[model samples]
Target: MSLAQGRSYLAIPGPSVVPDAVLRAMHRASPNIYEGELVEMTAGIIPDLRAVARTQHHVAIYMGNGHAAWEAALSNVISAGDHVLVPSTGRFCVGWGEMATGLGAEVELMEFGTKTPMDADAIETRLRADKEHRIKAVLAVHVDTSTSIKNNIAEVRAALDGAGHPALLMVDCIASLGCDRFEMDAWGVDIMVTASQKGLMVTPGLGFVFFNDRADAVRAKMTRVSRYWNWTPRANPEKLFEYFGGTAPTHMLYGLRAALDMIHAEGLEAVWARHETLARAYWAACEAWGQGGPLTLNVADRAHRSHAVTALRLGAPHGTGLRRWTEHQAGMTLGIGLGMSEEGDPNGDGFFRIGHMGHVNAHMVLGTIATMQAGFDALGLPYGAGALDAATKVISGKA
Candidate 1:
């Protein structure tokens, strides 16, 4: 059988569309691992990487996924039996808290469910109760891809300060790094962890952990952080080998370099504005579609929605069917609905998500919206017409 001739769209929450430049950069033989352009290029990544996080601190690169970065961040700052506060807005937050629990830390989870942002006042109350300051750190995800909720790290910092809590602020920026604006230093975040797959516009394999002086203090005082997960040598590596703590992910480095160049060339402000514009367009389209039925956005407020991903509920079991139809028929892959179902509900019975992240532009956004609208029509779902037009107008600033 013959396949479709046109391009196949990958609209998942992560492992997003990689740029041609990044792919070309990664297509090369292994460079000299010891001391050469690779080493020089690797050293230069720190400054650019710091620039991406909007920080002037140390960063540790790891040859693993976001999970590895999670372990590295936790292990470096919080030791066994320590206490940490995690504000759960979505699936990734819960997962990070669970990692802390597994690492022998007592975790206090302040869950806000999947559709809303975590209340800073509630977090303040929780921190204020810890008068002894037993909480060693606070784990917060900047953007939870599973539920498309974007929590406020800066507000969380303000809450911590209001309560006078002396805990490190750790952020999971895996899905928000390049797609959303995350100012680590401005947000008063101590440690920000991320991976290469999502907003960075690269394939999976590399993870990064950005740390400030506050986190360095914790690292110096913390006891028994694993060697593999240790950030001490990785951050302040005396030798090139210590940069990765072992063999480096060469091809991924190439891709990352290309992605960084793209980000810098376009300028961070432009990149952020583009993402905001596209996200608003997506929400506008969703609002139009939900006019006739129970198809509503997961986040009640637009401010809480992630710029990279949009989670929705159709109030029908046909959501999964719609997703499949969109992918197989329209060749547009949508993200699976995760962490949006209740205990009694079947697996994502009424939810679906659209990932409009890295390397996506106006045309790509329009294409995705058109394909989804097609699915809605094919499935006989209740939706108003001109949803795409409204979205296009929003993006183009015509309405």
Candidate 2:
């Protein structure tokens, strides 16, 4: 008999679980777009967004996804023939580099593969070699959702300083902003791009680009910028329409306001700690299971792994089979092994991912782990004992 009859969990990396509060906030009739509570509420949202990003800089809201923010940020400071360095750790960084390339910028990619974090030393070496500082900016991803690798932004910043390079440090924090700890201003990030879907506990629609004065100065020197993708007016809009370059995303603003409130109420530091603990719990469970089985984590080192998502390798058909079993029988869904294609497994059928970001608690994480263990048993997959025990110990702070 099928047991997947209740509220099924979507444990993918992005478009994470939206909070009930955010949903309720979005369940209202559309408000006045011109002037009213919506406008006033949106004014308050800017500061709160700054607080979440730990920045005292400017933020522009776009009515698009993370890709929109990526383009928007690039449109401001990057002109035709500009050179940009991309230190790619996974698929997302490469995508960002591609976006820059499409915008008529010269892109140099420094691939760090998929299993490990970006090497700060290598980035420093390259920047030092650029004697004329032809590279206008260094695009980096704080956390790659596909590989679940978290790079050290501070170390990257230090590399720039070590090389005495004046290149702007642009970061993609779409998957890390609220789930993983990010300090934009402190990390010396000139620009940061993020979406509302993942860590903010909101649905996909709104995108944000946070920038400091240094980045704005570079934007000022740009010869031409597309009006639609420009961030200046959106950051300091006189009218409501200018906030989004057109009509606002009304319901998304409300939901985002509520999500921001929830975030502040819980406290950012505590939120980060919660994610860290939950991720450790997941790792503990996976390590226990890997003792006797093919199940293993993609990133071996805990320091380099993202606290928001965990990628796993279970070998070929088993990965696909387990994901299907959990969704069909246990009412739980897992994330696919995105950008993890291998020789025989072109579709990445030998991999899966577990998202423990936003709105996830100890019970949710523990339950997912337990259900995965059950899936292993039902599929006749050999696994070690004490997985649940190991996970529980982590959540209980006894590990």
**Best candidate according to lDDT:** 2
Candidate 2, 220-279: lDDT as tens digits: 888889998889899999999999999999999999999999999999999999999999
Q: Which stretches of candidate 2 lie over 4 Å from their true place?
A: none
Tens digit of lDDT per residue, candidate 1, span 89-143? 9889999999999999999988888888989999999999998999999999999
Q: For this target, which candidate reaches the highest TM-score against the unseen true structure?
A: 2
Report the number of backbone clashes for model 1. Answer: 0
Candidate 2 yields a Cα-based lDDT of: 0.94
The per-prediction CA RMSD against the true structure, in angstroms, equals 1.4, 0.8
State the RMSD for candidate 2: 0.8
- TM-scores of all candidate predictions against the true structure: 0.97, 0.99
Report clash pairs, candidate 1. Answer: none
